[model samples]
Target: MNRRETRDAVVHFGPDADWVREAAAESSAVAAADGVASYDEPEADAGAADAAGARLAVCELSPDAGVEALAAVRDALPTVPVLAVVADADAVDDALAAGAADVLVRRDGVDDTALLARRMEGVAATPAESRLGAESTAQLLDAIDDSFYALDADGAIRRWNDSFSRLTGYEDEELAGMDALELFAGADRERIAGAIETVVETGSATAKAELVARDGETTPVEFTGALVTDADGSPSGIVGIGRSLTERREREARLARLRQAVETIVDRAPLTLFEVEADGTVSTVRGETLPERLGRRVSEGDAAEGVFADQPEMRRHVAAALDGEPAHGLVEVGDSTLEAWLQPALDETGRVTRAVGLALDVTEREERAVMLDQIQASAGEVIWISTPGKESMDFVSDAYEDVWGRAPETLRSDPMSFVEAIHPDDRERVEAALTEQREDPDAYEETYRVVRPDGEVRWVHDQSSGVYEDGELTRIVGIATDITVRRRRERELRLKNRAVETAPVGVAIHETAESAGPITYVNEAFASVTGYDGDAVAGEGLSALAGDDTDSDRLHAVASAVKTGDRGSATLVLYRADGTPFWGRVDVAPVVDGDGEATHAVSFVQDVTESKEHEQEIERHLTEFGEVLAEDLGVPLREARDRLDAATDDDPDADLRRAEESVERAVSLVEDLATVHSFSVEPRRLSESMRGSSPAPAGRDE
Candidate 1:
């Protein structure tokens, strides 16, 4: 019997006690291993539990013995783990709320005794061994949920709870005696040390820092610390809880960016931002004296309708927006004209929460015919003039025919016919954009697909500015340019980048001359091979990746290729971040522009250590064979040749015959050696790669 197994258990009786009995029976086989003792209901009180060695408390939850029964069991064994068997759904929550350590819903009839034994083993030791009654310090510390750490007076971590261990990615053994300040860095460590000093002077203090983990990952954390006082009233140590501030910091950054964007539009531009309640109350308003220019006297927290009391059209637009649908209108009050766009803000359940809107003043518009009467269109440009509100076209440029593949007469005849050239999917959005531009000309910049008469769709980027004379606005001038080729190039570049990013071999792109310049990009494979993350190496020079001991010849070869605007390759030893060396064949290709001059260079690296070692082994074996061939056969052949050369006229035939036989023997030896080496074996590979967009090596596995 081990200490982890239950020695004593308490079971509380209720009307549905049969469920508890069934569970206990299913687990009785293992429960009997330690000569387990049991105390039924009201008999073994919490005070008597210590003497009885009670380690686990079991109870059945029902209307008869629900919260009240569970509370009594908790009081009897405060620190002991309580396993509650629940028959209905309602009692599960009730048992948990009453401090049950674990609740087992009546599912699958409690068929597995091994699982029950596992849960029992997970509980703490008996109160006499661990704490005064049944109180478990580990459980109490973990109950904090947030990271809990204890630091000594010297700022070294003396103790930490499970939460702190998990959050910091450190094991219990690794955390002991670790400097608490080491978990943070730089200015943060100094600030945290100051905060600890503050805690010693005061009662409590709070500070924030980025908590760096075992693997160098940092988490933004807010820590609250308090001083622990000894009997002499002197500071002994400090204890603190660290709460993660990652989400809060991210949300704050996002909100700050949004506020900056909104302020830029409402403050710098001639626009007013407003939010109103259902009861016609203005809750928010922002702008640069736009309200004053529009003769609006009401401020935020005032009645919204009173802001436009002199203009009934604007008042109706606000009311219509609050009711259900979006509304917009133009109001002419005194000498200025105003355009307002209002829509209801919907909640998660699609309920209308409030009405928000932007108002623009457009009283100084100029006549379009007078502004564009003398301007001429340039190449690839479509300069057009229309009515003050774009109700009809007054003039169209020749470039319109070149880009839209139709004459300008059609648009002049029917101003709305411009929609016919827009792609079907984009026609609605384009129409809405045009309508918005007609209402407020400053909002006219757009990019949309324009379909020609010949069925070729082209992308058009158009921008326009309003023309005004004196104080009355009258015209809108626009320029539309064809951007189909640029769009195609951008899309193709993206696909090429994707192909490069997923290439198998390590790949790096530099500004120019290999790594002589700054490194621009590296894919995941590069990071895997080098053990240096992209963020760590990008924008750094080659010195960051290679040391003085690394091969300079191969690197110089790649640089020479870049200088000559040619592709080149060389074999070299490359080192990972841990200084593990591998034989690498690096191929560098220059990226050229239209002038055929290199603007950038891409380097592809493959580990060739295995294949290079194999080739070396083959060469070594061949060298040994050559030496053996000379020692075993070279003398005999040489003697035969000398005997033939020294033969007299009469005996020359004999010597000649002997030399011929030796020659035949040499021929046989050569043939035999050729046969032995005839079997073809494919060379081993460094890597096998799929067909990629760029140049890459194909190597089979060793």
Candidate 2:
């Protein structure tokens, strides 16, 4: 037959036994090739076998009888490529092992016998070159890194590469005739077997399994299997390739562990942590148990579009972060406040893919800050904090209005404004003190002046401490107290002391000791009288000025009396520094204490030297005057007495008459002189004695 006619001469083997009817229609124009006569059943099988050396047989096995029937068919026609037709694809593997060259799984609306005959013709026409070419292809596959295997229809291994042996830890001798199911680990055996059956039935399957090696080590593997078709275009067996997934699975497990560890840390932290996706969908909320509002999932629409949302500022910040800008702010969440920080998630191209949020609960800190502000507002002193520049104040307390006569907000704008309010005279001193305090933080005190709005000046005492960050001065925080009243009181006391220092008179002060002794404090007058400077006897005992002849007992008694609030006077001999003596009357009085105790003594002394001399002169004058008066009387009376003696003895009469005039005159003159002398002498003597005796011993009533 010609090439084209020969294609038509090959009868597609589907019509039951109507060969004559087909041949009569074709005529002899295309002669049919002499081949085989076919029969449908066992009764005509002998004739069909006699006509052609080989008999075409079609067999269908029940799901249970499939394997046994295939085996019997293989013994009957060992050389024929039996095309076994099966209802299910699962029987294809057993059929191929029983010497069936190909298999066809029945599908709806398909002529199986005709389809098989066409496929056979196409196979027969192909040269042996294709088979040899397939051998070379298998060799190339063996060179790859992956394990490859082909199982026969009997579920037995047909061919495999060296990689299979290496991967399974099996030698060629042990694996050549073994069942492929033996390579599966116990956990994967049933799964692998089921996959093989699926591939046989469906012509393709895929499975991942843990496979066991000859040494009992397990490795994760992925298997991709396909049915190997025969000449009749029917499934004959399964060919599978395995790839070791050990490294891939290990990577996945490590990633899982890392994620778990991160979650654990975030959950245990006191601060909140969260993640936002590209669309602003929040996920992965973790922290100390927080309010439900914080834990709720937030979407872009919820943040950007919703009204009555409390965290509008936070939402704006997060939106900015998604746009590749970082933002941080304070916001109030459900039941707590937080300081929220938003960062951008970057992709490989350095573009922001999403935003991640990290929130810290700062509720307690905010509350404390508010309370501190209230306390500062109520303080009586001005409180402030300054930066290292010393040129500005960041925070100033409200009490600045009372202490510095300026609003706290004014100082906050310009810290130097407070400095300008200082009194010009005190400005330099205040600056020096502040500079010194800054240099040595331990020197924390400063005094300065502040001029009020009413033009009154006030003294301010500032106590401060340096705040250091990284060994650099960051700020100075301190308080300023108004000390103007205290300073005024101090000035008044100084003026009063000056008045007491210059007082007149020899006023000496004695300090009473705990042991009832006395120490002297002499003023300038006391120093002049004692011929010693005030410093010379400052701490000396009061008795140090007395001489050995001085009446010590009387002096002690006077001191004791004076200490008990009784005034005393004494005519005592005082010893000078040169060991000379002087008699003077001294008066002592108590310096009473607050509790009415005589804790000190004060003595006022005056010199009586001139007065004592005047008294002595007066006494001598009186004595001379008395003597002259007696003598004059005696002389005058002698004349009168001689005349009066003759009259009183004879002069009582004649001397009374002639001497009566002389005698009377003599008596009158004598009486006048006597009276004058007596008056002068008596007054002078009494005055001198009284001046000397006015002082008595201590404790005496005078």
Q: Pick the candidate with the highest lDDT.
A: 1
The 10 consecutive residues of candidate 2 with the worst lDDT sum are 1-10
Which residue runs does candidate 2 get wrong by more than 4 Å?
1-385, 391-403, 444-446, 461-472, 477-481, 513-517, 548-558, 561-573, 583-702
**What lDDT tens digits, residue by residue, belong to model 2 across residues 1-702?**
111222133222222334322432343322233533333432213222331233233444455434444444434434333445567876554454344445667775754545545544443343434321446446655676778788888778878888888998988888887899988866699999999888877666779999899999988898877666553445667776788898888999999998898777666655767666676566546664323436554442343323215678977887888889999988887667888888998999998888887777788999999898888867788878887556888888888898777788787777778778888998888777777766765567878888999998898888888888898777888888988899998899788556545665566666665334444566666666556566776666546568865678767766665455567777665666665554555677887878987777777665554465466567668767776977766676767656666666642555357646767777777777766766676545544554464443345444
TM-score of each: 0.37, 0.40
- Over 4 Å off in model 1, which ranges? 1-377, 469-472, 513-515, 541-549, 563-566, 620-702
RMSD (CA, Å), each prediction: 42.9, 18.0
In model 1, which range of ten residues has the least summed lDDT? 685-694
**Candidate 1 lDDT tens digits, 1-702:** 012334445333344433334444445332333334334442223334442445566665554433445555566666666777666654553354345666666655556445555544444233335532324545766776677777878888986667788889998888889888888889998988889888877745789888999999999998877665443446677766787888888899999999999998788877878788777777547884435766666566777667777779878888888887899887786876777899998889988888998878766542243344444444568887776666788767878898899888988888778778999999898888888886677778888999998899999998777777895667777888899999999999999889888889988877875445566888888887777777887876444556544578767766667555578888876667776555667787888889987888777778776676666558546644755665567677667656656663447677577776777678567555544444312221211111121123356432
* lDDT value, candidate 2, whole model: 0.64
